[model samples]
Target: MPLEIVMSVSFARAGLILGLGLTVASGACAPLRSHQGYIIDADLVNSVQPGVDNRQSVAQVLGRPTIASQFGAEDWYYVARDSRNLNFQKPKPKEQITLKISFDPSGTVKSVTRTGVEQIAKVDTFGKTTPTLGKKRGFFEDLFGNIGTVGAAGAGGPGGGGGGGRDTP
Candidate 1:
């Protein structure tokens, strides 16, 4: 083969390999989208009318709820979240929907409430340690601070003889 043709072929192969590598690398950085919990269908959700729908009908139309009320009024919550994560980052919610169906004692739906992403709260954590009320102590203090207090007076220790016990002369 001619030297010029040989060099041109080698360069073409290298360019093609480099282009493919770049494409693959770019795809990896793209955001990954995920859907969690109940899948919402506008028509189906709207079809459930208050006062007309009961537990059996609601379950058939919307399936089981994400969570049911543990206290107070009987309610069913259908939660849906669409999240996106780029590369190795934690997934953040891009959209959220919380559908609350409140039922009366007779199992009839009292009301249907829909909440959107506006209800999402963003909480910023301080660090690894939780923020607690009370005097902050050092590592050594936490380890040894209780040494003298364990058997101290009025501590209900073996010799402390709490006030509830009968007095001995």
Candidate 2:
């Protein structure tokens, strides 16, 4: 290769490598994030015995639950998720924990359970259509459907409308 051509090729290669390095470095420098709901420690959760812990004792140990059942069953839930996102892309879920504690009517912990991300359920809609009861018309039919119906209901004026005081012959 000619010296001039070789030198230009080396410069181009160097620029490409530098650009790649900067891209990789920028990603590596991004802060790893753990956006969680309720960050409860495993040891603390174990401290509360299922049969022994009452509402107050559990509250004291685990603090208030992230959410309590609003309807029928009395269940306290502590859920947390760890995710990391690059720039503004969708965050990737690294880990998830869900602890559900059921309480008896007497307000004592009845059962304690721990769950992982595997329990997550992905729901999907069935179809992209809705069934309705109505006549389906074509685009052109709907556009010109009312064109000749405007004054058909009454003479250009209101039906039965009184005319001038002088009666027409």
Candidate 3:
């Protein structure tokens, strides 16, 4: 009976140690945050015809715009943006962008518009300067340089090594 108790205790300790090791290793390999922004309702914009779509009807079709003109009140902005921290790493976009469609006083579509300033990248910039390290690197350099390193692997890692046993050679 005493021997059985000792063996069980030993097994318990081993399991605890293994669990702790796994927890720490997982914590260390958290992914880098990734941000993705794009126009979600582009189809809604294309469907509207300048002459056919009126203010009330357009509102019914596209739901509502994100921003409205405070002064004019005739303009409507339908905007959708998605910014994700795939791992929650660094500072990302403070602003988002979408298409702006305007209506004239007669209630037909007046102008279809977008400003370059507000549109976020569908994919985050890769070749530009990295904010965390404050250094810029070319696209290929960042790709190959970080590949297969111990730090980069996480759940659904880019290389397909950590989460699943299967990986592309």
Candidate 4:
């Protein structure tokens, strides 16, 4: 091949490799989407009327609830979350819907309430080790701290007891 053609081919190959690498890198950076918990159907959810729908009818329309209230008044919660994450990062909620169906004593739906991502609470964790109130002990101290303290005076050792409430005769 001619010198000019050879150089041209080399440049073409380099361009092709660079393009492929960029495509793969861009794909890696793409956000991964995930849906968790109850899959909401708008029509079905809307069809369930407060007084008209009871526990059985609600279940038939929306299926099982994500969680039911264990304490207080009876409430069924249908939770749905759409989250996205990049690479190996923790998934963050893009959108969240919580459908709360409050029930009366007769099992009839008292109210149907919908809440969005605004209700989500972000809690900032301090550190890996939880803050505690105590004397900070080292590894060796925790391992062998009770060495001499086990049979020490006033610690219910063999010599710690008085002579069984009797006088020596």
Give the best candidate by lDDT: 1
Question: What TM-score do all the candidates reach, one by one?
Answer: 0.75, 0.60, 0.47, 0.77
Tens-place lDDT digits, model 4, residues 22-140: 99999999999999999998999899898989999999889999999999899999999999999999999999999999999999999999999999999989998988898999999
1-169 in candidate 2: lDDT tens per residue? Answer: 8999999999999999999999998988695786689997989999878779999998998998998999998999999998887766767777889999999999999999999889877666658976678998889998898886654544353343334245569
> Which regions of candidate 3 fall more than 4 Å away from where they truly are?
1-13, 20-39, 86-91, 94-96, 114-169
Q: Which pairs in model 3 have colliding backbones?
A: 65-77, 65-78, 66-77
To one decimal, what is the Cα RMSD in angstroms of model 3 from the true structure? 23.2
lDDT of 1: 0.94
User: Model 3 compared with the native: what TM-score?
Assistant: 0.47
**Descending-lDDT candidate ranking:** 1, 4, 2, 3
Model 1 agreement with the true structure over 109-166: per-residue lDDT tens digits = 9999999989999998899988899999999999998898875778887666655466
Model 2 steric clash pairs: none
Residue-level lDDT for 9 in candidate 1: 100
Output the TM-score of candidate 2: 0.60
Candidate 4 error regions (>4 Å) = 1-16, 143-146, 149-169
Which residue pairs does candidate 1 place in steric collision? none
lDDT scores of the candidates, listed in order: 0.94, 0.85, 0.68, 0.93
